[model samples]
Target: MFKNAVQLFEIFGFKLRVDPSWLLIAALIVWSLSTSYFPEAVPGETRTLYTVLGIIAMLGMFLSLILHELSHSLVARSYGLKVGGITLFIFGGVAELEEEPHDPKSEFRIAVAGPLMSLFLAALFYGLTRLAADGTEIGLTGAVFGYLALINLVLAVFNLIPAFPLDGGRMLRAVIWQMTRDLLRATRISSRIGSAFGLFLMLTGAFAMFSGGGIGGFWQILIGFFILNASNGSYQNLLIKSALRGKTAQNLMSSRVHTIDPGASIAELVDDVMLRQGVSFVPVVSGERLLGYVDTAGAQSIDRSEWGMRRVADILVPASPENTAAPATPLDQVFKRIGLMPRRKLMIVEGQRLVGVISLSDLVHHLALEQEIGTSLRG
Candidate 1:
C-alpha cells in the first residue's frame, strides 16, 4: 500500500518508507472513536478533551512504532547487516535489513531489541503519568497516555508470538541455526512453526467471524490472512534455499555437445541434421570457439529441408550475454532468473566451447533430487 513515503526525512542516515496503509488505520481509529467512544462521553468538555487526546494517542503510536524499528535497525547495522530502511505500516513497523544475521547471538539481539524498546516506551509513558506533579485529575491526558502505554505493551507481547516474518520467528530461526549449524534446516523448522501459528490464528478468526461478533472478528480474520500468507512465503523461501545448497553446474552439465561450422556445404550440413544429435539447436563455432546457436527451423528459410543447409553464418541466433551462467553459480540466482524468463536456457560455457545447457526442466529435476536427499538425510 506504500507510495513514496521514504521522502519523509532522514533519521540518522536511515531512510523511512511509511506505507500508505497507515492512513487507512488512522481513519479507522478516528471513525471508531466518533461512532463509539465519542457518543458515550460528556458533551462539551469530553469532546474537546478527547479530540486532542485522540490526536496525541495517534502520534504516540506512530512514535512508538518508529522507536521499535530504530532499535532493530541500529542493532542490525552494528552487526554488519545493511539497514535498507524502516517501514511503518497498518500492523506495525518493519526494519529492513539487507541480509539475515550472521549468528544466533546477533539475531537474538536484533529481535529482542524491538520488544525491549517497546517495554521501555511503555514504562516511560507510565512514569510520566505518575510524576505529573500538578495533581491533575486522571482526565483525557491520563487516559490517552495510559492507553498508549498499554498499546506498546501489547505490541511487544504480540510480536513475541513465535511466528515467521515476525521478530519471534527470526529469533527461533537464529536459535535453531546455532544448534543445528545449518541455516537452511533452521529456516525449514521455523517456517513450519510459523505456518502452524498461521493455521491456529485462521481457525480462531474463522470462529470469531462466523459468530457474528462484527468488527473485532473481521479484524481477526484480516490478521489471520496476513499471517497465513507470510508463513507460506517463508516456507517457500526455505525450499528454495534447500534446493540451492552445495550445487555447482559442473557436476550436472552435459559435456557432449554439437557445434556448427561458420562455413560449410549446405547439402552436407543437412545430412548432419538428419542424424539427430538429441538437441534442437547447436552452437555455431570457428576453430573451437563459440559464435552463436543455430536451430533447424532457421535453416529452413533457405529450403534446408530439401537443400540440407550446413553453414551457420546467418542462421544462428545472436549469443545473448545474459543467457550464460558460470559453472559455480548459486542455484538461488539461477532459479530467480528462470522465473523471469521461463523459455530461456543457460548456455554453460568454460571459455569458448559449449559446456552444457541449463533449462527449466533441469532446475525442476534438481529440486526433486534435493527433496529426495533431504528425505534421506532426515530419515
Candidate 2:
C-alpha cells in the first residue's frame, strides 16, 4: 500500500516507514499546534516560541505513534505472525501483518496491544506534565507534555470504539467469534457495524460542516470515508483468502510450460522463443533440470549487438524463492509471492525439475470459473 514510503529506521527488527502523505499531515499538525494550540495553552508565549513548541509536540506525537504500532508488532511476532513493517500515512500508523492471527485469542491480543500502549504513554506523559509544571519557569515544557498526554488519551479512547478494523472493532469481533465459533460470521457482523459507524461519522461531519465547524468537519468526513472503505476492503480480502484456503500450486499451475535451453544464445531466445511464441518468461532448463529463468526485461538489458555473444545463462535470473515455488506449496502462499513479482509469475519446481508455472491470470481465471459455476467458496 505504501509504494512511495521512505524508510526511516528499524527498531526491534521492525522497519518504520513514512509515506509521502504523512508529510502533508505532519505539516498540518505543526501549523495547527504553532498557530492555535500552544498559543492558547501558554498565554504569554511569543509566536516563535509557540512554533518551536509545536514542532516539539509534533515530534513527540510521532514518537508516540511509533511506540503504539511497535507494541502491536511485538505482540504479533510473539504469536508467530510475520509483520511486513510499520507505515505512517496520512491517517496514522499501521502494523502490517503478512498473515492474520491463527485464532481469535491471538487476534484479540494483537488488536488490543496498540490502545493499551497508548494508554500507558498517556499516563506517563501526564505524570511528566505535572513534574514539568512544578520545575519549569516558562511553563512551555509542561504545556507540551500536557498536550501529548491529552492526545494520547484521545487516541486510546477513539480506538476503543467498537468499529471493525479498529482496535475496539477487532475486540468486538473476537468476543463474537468466541461465542459463535464462526470467524467469517463474526467478521461480517463487525464489518457491518464498522460501516454503519463510518456512515454515522460522515453524516455527523456533514451536519457539523453545515453548522459552521469548517475544517474540523471536513477532516471528520475524510476520516469517515477512509474507515468505510477500509472496512469493506478488509472483508473482501478475507473472502478471497477463504476461497483459496485448500488450494495449492499443483492445483492451479499450467504443466505445459515453455522452456529454453540455457546454452541457447540470447539472440535465439529473443528471436525464436520470445517473439515467435509471444512468451515473456521462459524457464532455462538443461535436461529437465531447472537452472533459472529469463524475461523480456533481462533480454532488453543487453545491447542488440551483444545479444549474439551472450547466452541465456548470462541473462537468466538464478532460481530462488522469489521466482520459484514447490508444486505442493499452498496457493495462498503462492498468491502472496506472485503479487511481489514484476511479471506476476512463479515457476512450480520439484527438486531441480521444473514441473509447471503459475501466473496471476491463472488464479483469476480459476476464481472466475468458480464464481461462474456458483460454487460457494467462501467460508
* Each prediction's TM-score versus the true structure: 0.73, 0.81
Error of 2 at 176 (Å): 1.4
Runs of candidate 2 exceeding 4 Å displacement: 130-138, 258-322, 368-379
Q: List the residue pairs that clash in candidate 1.
A: 266-308
Local lDDT at 21 for model 2: 95
Q: For each candidate, what is the lDDT? A: 0.74, 0.90
lDDT of the structure predicted as candidate 1: 0.74
RMSD of each: 5.5, 4.1
Top candidate by lDDT: 2
Q: Mind giving the per-residue lDDT tens digits that candidate 1 earns over 1-379?
A: 2455545777878888777888888777666554455344323465556566566678788889999999999999898899988888777788877666888899889999999999998898887766642464545556666767788999888888788767888888889989999887787788778877877877787888788877777777777777778777766666766677677766665666667687865554555752555566666778767777666576667765545434567666765667667777776677767566534566677677677777777778877888888789989
Q: What digit string (tens of lDDT, one per residue) describes model 2 on residues 1-379?
A: 7899999999999999999999888899999999998888788868999888888999999999999999899999999999999999998899999988888999899999999999999999999889888544428888899999998999889989999988999999999998998887898899999999999899999999999999899999998998898888888788668768899999999999878999899999989998999899999999989998999999899998999989999888988878999988998888888999989999999998999999999988876776556345453
Following a full C-alpha superposition, what root-mean-square deviation does model 1 have from the true structure?
Answer: 5.5
